[model samples]
Every structure is written in structure tokens, then in C-alpha cells.
Target: MDKNAATDAAAETPTQDTAQEPPLAGRVALVAGATRGAGRALAVELGRAGATVYVTGRTTRERASEVGRTTETIEETGELVTAAGGTGIAVPTDHLDEDQVRTLVGRIEREQGRLDILVNDLWGGEHLLVGSVFGKRSWETPLADGLRILELGVRSHVITAALALPLLVRSDAPLHVEVTDGTAAFNRRYRENLYYDLAKNAPIRIAFGLGEELKEYGGMAVAVTPGFLRSEQMLAHFGVTEENWRDVIARQPDFAIAESPHYLARAVAALAADPARASRWNGKSTSSGELARVYGVRDVDGSRPDALAYFEEVRFSGKPGTPDDYR
Candidate 1:
């Protein structure tokens, strides 16, 4: 289905329930940087599971951030979450500003009393990937651009977790999801750019260190990555729409294993709803494909695309196989 059709269907009738009550009924969640992509989907899925979600981002209907895209806004994300069956509150926040983060957390605490899930998905450095970052040595890259990437992808996550954890720990079952570009194992090799490498890997360590700290309070922290994600920005990059993304596979063969942002969003919702997530996932790094398999969840198109496995066994390894074999 198209995005609108899915939203209309969800708004008219909730489909995330198989029991008497939605799994996350009455829970409260904060999805940081939910203006678009996986973060936006995460907010909506959490709402579908019956959790009140506070979605934050730098972009609002009134303004756009440095990422430069104005088509999507946090206000629209908030509406989508509410339409999906939970309370959605859009809060404009620049996590790098500690004061803004502190106020955001304070408002959540005042309005909800406690936070059940914290999803740190605040990276917005993709615009730096082309001329500014890629194919350059650390010495060759622009210092300002490199630092901006770290500020957006790494420091923001740290700031959000630091300010939000006090309220998050108060919940009976708290989940902290550090969303990043690649899994710990996958990122062992250099990511072609020094700054990008550090930016992505930092979240994995954040989850590990936070897990150690949060365990004492009965909270779980895990790093999660999505496969070749077909995000809105990515679709635009490939010059295709979600409904016709297959047309680009001929030029970009690896795109065959691409999964929708909703795949990772569902994985996060499953993690939030799982009673034993602390024992099973705390301090570990995982991917949407791995979680989907564990939770028996499928993507919107009804397939579980394991892009990492495909890359490791086929693309990088030069094994003779098609993306279909992995997807």
C-alpha cells in the first residue's frame, strides 16, 4: 500500500492488536529526531502499540533545520502518531543545546510522570556524506563539517540520554534504543570516512555503557540498525517513489535487499513490548532483520530483508548469489 492508504487504514481502524489490549497501552515513549525516516515510523508504530509518544526534531512546520528538506515536519509526525491510536506530542528540540533537552525531558516528566521508552534517533549528518565527507582522508576533510557530523550524530545522542534517563528509569520496564547506521560487527571495518565511522560506532558503545548503568535500575539499552533502508531521503536520492522503487534495482543491485523504515520501527515496538528484553538484548547490538526474525515480525511487503547478511555473504564476500536469496 501507499503511505497515505496505510495511514488512512490505521487511523480508521487500529491493526497492531492481537489481544484484548494493545501491548503498550498506557505506556509513554519519547522518540527523539522523529521528523522523518525510521524515527518517524518508530513514533507511529509505538502509538499503534498504544503508547503515548512525544516526537522531537529540529524541523517543524514553521522552520527547517540544516538538513534542508522542508517537505516533512515533526508536527506531521505527531499527527500520524495520534492517528495511529496514541497521544502524539511534537516538541521542537535541538538536542545539542543542553537547555532544550533538559526542558524537553522536564515537560515529559510533568505531563506523563514517567517515560517507558527512549529512542535516540537524532542523526542528521547525511547531507555531509557527499562532497564534504566521502573519499577524503581525515586531514583532507573540512574540520567544521566533520565536527558538525559528530555533533549531530554522537553528541546529540549523549545529550538526549543524559537528560532523559532520570524520567525513563522510573518506569517499571524501560527500554533505551540507540538507533544508528550499522551494527557493531558490521562497522568493524572503516566506513570510508573517519568522522562517519566514529559517528555510527559511538551509538553502539553508548548502548553498551548505558546498559551497564541502567541494569541497576532494571532498564534495558540496545543499539539497533536497519538494513538498506528505503527512507524518504533515500527514495529521492534514487529518483524514485516508494511505489516504484524497484526501477532503481537494475542500477543499484544491492537495493534489492532494501527494507522499509517500518521494518525497523516494528522491531523497536517489539523490543518495547517484550517482557524479557532486558535479559535478551541489553548491552547488545542488533539489526532490524535480526529482531524481526526473533519476534516473527515481517516488513510491510511481508518479507524480512537482511541487508547485512546479504552484504557480508554476497556483496562483500563475492559469493555467487542474488539479493533475492537473502531477502
Candidate 2:
């Protein structure tokens, strides 16, 4: 048996949502690439909403993933979920490997028997990736690397969807979230480099394609982005802790509107629990801040930082403004 397989453990009810039992109680979710950042937080949030989440990623205690940046592992993420009142199962999976991903889905079937939500938050394939890890001009990018990146960034997503389709369709109105770096509107401009731009935009396209296919089955798919995410890597790059992330604004004012990974988690949790209109967001590109308005969930700081709005109004407009301008 795969160490990742479950043992028919009893389901748990999230106690944090004091108003009532969590809407996702007894639900099962698979959060791919959940070792860190938005994926980690999203898995935790699903747990908080009373969902049994199988968290998969390459980073584990026994091995460091290609990200080479953090010790955060999928096991730690699962532990956090369990602590938050939902079941968390950790599975180290390399999404690019068809055999590994296939076995993962099979384990889920043997254990949980159903998969209700599928969040394709895959990344962390830089070493195995086809393109330059450092953003390079299209002409300058090595052809082999560029093609491999297409496999890592784009093909991995399709592989997951193709394999998970059977399990996902079993649930009523299953929700699939394809996490991307930017909204479709924002990615219209170049993003540092050609490969990077395409990689980011690919997820949105995947969501659109899946949205079209899933509609017939009464399921939904959407591309989601976090507003200027203060992910672990970003925070490390800025040389600040989440406790003092404000310090980064002095060097990069755009950082002022940065949101935690949990913000994206809130957006996902809200969508999953929305029994009435979650499908309305299908084929759309959304952010945690915008979804805050629809779902009424705030960031850890209790304010919704609309990063895209801030970028357009303050960054692109060449105007200086406080974070409040966006919040």
C-alpha cells in the first residue's frame, strides 16, 4: 500500500466556523503542489472548512524539491491541516511523472473513494523544467529548456486533469481551481520574459479549456491568482518575515499591497462552500481580494488588499499611495 493511502479514518468537522458546521464537512480535496505558498495555505483552508485534503508536492523531509529554497514539506502542510480541524494526508508526488500521478489518484479511490475538489496548484519543477529558471529573452532562451518548461508548466496541469477527471466527476458540481500567477487581463502585458509569460498564461487557458469541458458535467473550473503574493519565496527575496513584511515597501512600494497565501486559501474555501453560485466563476480569472467582496472573507490582517487594482492605479499610473488606497 502507498504510504499516502488512507485507512478509512473517521471524518472531522471544522470547529473554527462557530456559526455552523463547515459546509465542506466530509468532503475530500486533493491539493497538488501543496508543499508551500498558496498551495500550502489553500490546503490548510480546505481543512479549516472541514475537508479531508490530500496534499501532494515534491518537497518532503527526505528530499528537497528543485525549488531549493525551503524546508517546508507536504507533511508539514498536512500537519497544519490536522491541527486546524480537518484531515490532512501528505503525499510526495512529482506531477510531471504520469505513473506517479496515476498511482496517487488510485490511492485516493482506494482510500477516500471520492474526490470533491481538485486544485491544480502545480509548480516547483524548475530543475526538470524545459526553460530558463531565470527569465530569459525568448531568442536567448535555450530551446531544450524552453520546451521542457512547457512540459513542466503546461503539460503537468493537463496530465493531472486528465487523470483526475473520473474521480472529480463523481462529486456534484465539483470545483477545480487552476492557480496562475496573474489574471488573463494582467498577463496581456509581457511578464519579465517570454517563457515566463507563456507559462503563467497557460494555466488560464487550461482553466478555460476545462471550463468548457466540465460544464456539460455540471462541474466548474477557473483560473485564480493572488494579489502580489507574499509567498515564502517572495518574503525571503524581500528579506522580511511575515511579521515585518511592511519593511519591504521602502525598497519596493508595490510590496505594500502584498497578501498572504492564506488570502488565496480564503478565496478557494469560499468558492468550495458556496453551494449556490460557485459555478458562476467558471472560466473567470479572480483574486483573493476581489473574491473577498463576493465571499466576505478577509485576509489575516482583516483587510482585502486588491493588488491588481493597486498595480493599475498606483504602479502603472505612476502615483504614490498608501496601502489603504487598494484595501
Candidate 3:
């Protein structure tokens, strides 16, 4: 379905049963990189749970951030969060800068008094520079370019997390989430992209390291990934509209089964609601499908797009495909 169709369908559906629950009422959350994609969705989901959310990102109406591609802005995300039933604050920030990140958190502390959740969704430009791919080597692209990607993808998250730690530690049920892509064990050079692989891997390690470090403070840290995210940017890249997203399955069969950002957002909400969630997911990296099973919540379409299972089944069954085979 296209965005309009989905919106209309949502309008027709009954109100969510959890609308009255307010699992996170009286809580404050900070979602870094909330301008678009997973970060934006997570902020809205947290809001649905009844938490005051601070949505920070570099992209704004006045000026665009490092990544030139445009979608929603932090202000737009904040509005969505507020519409979901919580107060939303949009703060323009570039996470790559340590001082900016610190200031962002300091302002949150001043306004909210305490932080309950922190989600680091910063990503470098690996996916953005798809044109640079040459043969099996990502390094063949450029040295300086790769380093720049590292700064945004890896360093930004580190800096933001460092600045937010003190405030997170002060919260009664502190939760930290590092967002990344895919699983660690499934690591196959990923189209032979060296910097991209490392940047993605680093977040998982950060989660594990922070999980151990925060043990003393009774805090939890974990990494989360979405399966085949059908993001607005990705749909535009593929020349497909959400209404006809299934059309891309012909080009990449796995694309047929895509999950919306809301799927992962629900996962974060479930984790925040669970009192024992820290013990279960601390230091671990999990996927949206896995979280759906654990939380018993459906995706926006009310279907569980189990991308992992689809991959496994295809691999075992030896499905035949080409760029347009699944179409």
C-alpha cells in the first residue's frame, strides 16, 4: 500500500488497545537522529506509550545536515510524537559534534529533570553512497571518503551516548538503544564493504560494552536492527511507491517482505515497558521480527514480516531468482 492507502486504512481501524495503557507515562526520552527512518518512528512509538520525547537531528527547515538527502525533519518527528499522545520537543543538533550532543542533553536535563530512554540512531553515508560500489572492494572508493563515513556512523553515536550517560544513569528505569543493521554472526563482508561493515559492527560492541559498564547503575543497553526497512528513502531509491512496494520484490525477492519503521518502534516500546527487559536484551543485538515474537505485537500492516525466516527458507529451498525474478 502507498502512504495514503496506509493512512486511510489506519483511520478506519479501531483505536489501539494500548492507547489507554500509558506504559511510559511521566517518562522522558531522547531519540538522536530523529529526522527520519527508524529514529523518527521510535520517537512516535515512545510517545504512544505516553512519554515526553526530545527529538534531535541535524536536518531542519533552516539548514540541512551532513547527509544531503531530505525527508522529514526533527520538527516533523516531534509533531508526530506529540500527536501520538506525549509532549514532543524538536532540537536541531549534529550528533557528530561532541559539544552539540552534550548541549542537547544538557538542555533535556534542564527541561525534563530526568531522562528515561536514550536511542542512538546515528548512521554514516554507506547506504547513501551506493554509486561508489566498485566490484567487491569498498576501499577502492576512496580513503578520505571512508573516514568521513566513519565519523558520522561510528563516532557520532559514541559521542551522543557519552553525553547522555550521566542523565540516563539518573533515571529510575534507564534504557539505552543503539540502532544498527543485520546480525553480527551473519557477517559476510557485506558486498565487500570494509568501512560499512566496521561501522555497523562497532554499534553492537558499543551496546555490549555499555551494557557491562552500566551494570553498576542498574541501566540497560542493547542494539536493535530492522529487517529490510521499507523506508521512504529506500522506496524513492528503488523508484517504487509504498502503494506498489511489492513491485520491488521482482528486483530483489527479499524486498517483497519489508518491514516498516513502526515495527522496530514497537520493539523499543515493548522493551521499555518490560521491567525485566534489561535482563533479557542487555548487551544483545536483536531484530524487529524477534522482538515482535517476544512482545506479541503486529506491524503497522498487522502482518509479521519475518525477513529472517524468509531468507532462511529461500536459502534452504534454493529459490531461483534474478533482479526481476520475484517481480
Model number with the top TM-score: 1
> Candidate 2 — which residues are off by over 4 angstroms?
1-19, 125-135
Clashing pairs for model 2 are 130-145, 130-146, 130-148, 130-149, 131-145
lDDT of 1 by residue, 179-293 (tens): 9988989998899999999999999999999999999888889999999999999999999998999999999988999999999998889888889999999999999989988
TM-score of each: 0.95, 0.90, 0.88
lDDT of 3 by residue, 197-248 (tens): 7778889899999999888888889998887888878888789877888888
For candidate 2, the lDDT comes to 0.83
Per-residue CA lDDT of candidate 2, range 56-132, in tens?
A: 99988988876785559889999999998899999889999999999999999999999999999997644533345
Off by over 4 Å in 3: 1-21, 124-128, 133-138, 188-191, 316-327
Q: In order, what is each prediction's RMSD in angstroms? A: 3.9, 7.9, 4.2
Top candidate on lDDT is 1
